[model samples]
Target: MGIALKIVLALVSVILTISILLQSSNSAGMSGSIGGGAEQLFGKRKSQGYDAILSKVSTVTAVLFIVLSLILVAIE
Candidate 1:
């Protein structure tokens, strides 16, 4: 892939990684399901609510990841 695409994808991948890490997991026990984990300071609900930006970020990242993989394959 082009350098620009790689750079942008890298940056996006980093953000996506961070977003996913910050968000709670789907199967993180009752704490995750109930939004009552040890890290639940204010909000940070486990469920992907309407304002769950991480979910969107994750979706975009997943698409980007797939696209990048395809691009790499095509290049090879």
Candidate 2:
């Protein structure tokens, strides 16, 4: 049971890491500067489509990761 929990914990950690990485950065930095006023004039679209999906998935996985961590501690 302990080993199973540990394995689940590891898998959740990996998923959390990947989901975080998959998320797009809020600030465009250089690219935004280069693009200039376009973002302002056009206005930033709300995160939709793929980004929205990733955001939701990442959120779910993050919660799962925390739960799994707690479970791992309990098992130990």
Candidate 3:
């Protein structure tokens, strides 16, 4: 059980990294970095198609990674 969980955790980590890398950058430079949060929060910017899918994938994988890490720690 522990070995299986470790394998799954490794896969999830790889997937999370890939999904993050595949997504397009939302911010431009210094200005965009400062204002990008508002744009995202207010729905001024939207993700479509590939970006949307990757965003969701990354989110889920990140959560899964954290949960798996905690579980592994607890098991140990």
User: By TM-score, who's the top model here?
Assistant: 3
* Models ranked on lDDT: 3, 2, 1
Model 2 pairs in collision: none
Q: Sort all candidates by TM-score, best to worst.
A: 3, 2, 1
List candidate 1 segments past 4 Å from native.
26-51
For candidate 1, give the lDDT of residue 75: 70
For model 2, residues 1-76, the per-residue Cα lDDT tens digits are 8888788878877887888898888777988778757877888886788788888888888898889888878767
lDDT of 1 by residue, 1-76 (tens): 4776777778878987887888764556865657655456565445657437778888888798779867866776
Which ranges in model 3 have alpha carbons more than 4 Å from their true place? 30-43
- Report every candidate's CA lDDT: 0.72, 0.82, 0.90
TM-scores across all candidates?
0.57, 0.72, 0.79
User: Which has the better TM-score: candidate 1, or candidate 2?
Assistant: 2
Local error of candidate 1 at 51, Å? 6.2
Clashing pairs in 3: none
Off by over 4 Å in 2: 30-43
Q: Distance (Å) between predicted and true CA of 51, model 3?
A: 0.6
How many Å off is the CA of 74 in candidate 3? 0.4
Q: If both were scored by lDDT, which would come out higher, candidate 1 or candidate 2?
A: 2
